[model samples]
Target: MSSDEEWSSGEDDSQPSKLVRKAREAPFVPIGLAGCLTLVAYGLYKIKDRGNQKLSVHLIHMRVAAQGFVVGAITIGVLYSMYTDYVNPTSSKPKK
Candidate 1:
């Protein structure tokens, strides 16, 4: 699959990932991603303007990888919590 196909967004014309299509899909995924990007930008700023300033080709992919990691982590966490709360029902109270 093409790069776009593999990472298509729900808001775009193309289809989104299955992880994003789930009922409990995080609405704030992009917001969390924005936070990652902001951190990356700040890192770039610090590395470029303040430190060694030597840019590397790998740094360009940092945004993509970090955002994916953030979204994936959140998705997994949500699914796990849903499973534990709804499917297993691990409360202290006894069932009537």
Candidate 2:
């Protein structure tokens, strides 16, 4: 094969390609942080509000807050998954 073709095909140039792959695989930090913060705030608010209510009302709020937290967590998971699978296409697999 021609030298130019060999070089362009990248068989001997693995390091840069590996670096590029690593960069692409990097996790998005900001969105993940936001999601975590949102979940924490929701939990705290639920706790604080629970102390100010009748038992029935408090239970209702707690239920709603639990749902919110779950949704937020799932949203973050889905977004990270999407970023890895489609947007970045090189990110590491999510930890089990």
Give the best candidate by TM-score.
2
* CA deviation > 4 Å runs, candidate 2: 1-52, 93-96
Top candidate on lDDT is 1
Per-residue accuracy of model 1 over 6-84 as CA lDDT, tens digit each: 6546565334555566523454566566668776876676664544434664475565766776787678767766776
Tell me the whole-model lDDT of each prediction, alpha carbons only.
0.62, 0.61
Q: What value of lDDT does candidate 1 attain over all alpha carbons?
A: 0.62
Candidate 2, 10-62: lDDT as tens digits: 68559988766654554334344455566557656666556556767765665
| RMSD to true structure for each model, in Å | 10.4, 12.3
How far is 14's C-alpha from truth in model 1 (Å)? 18
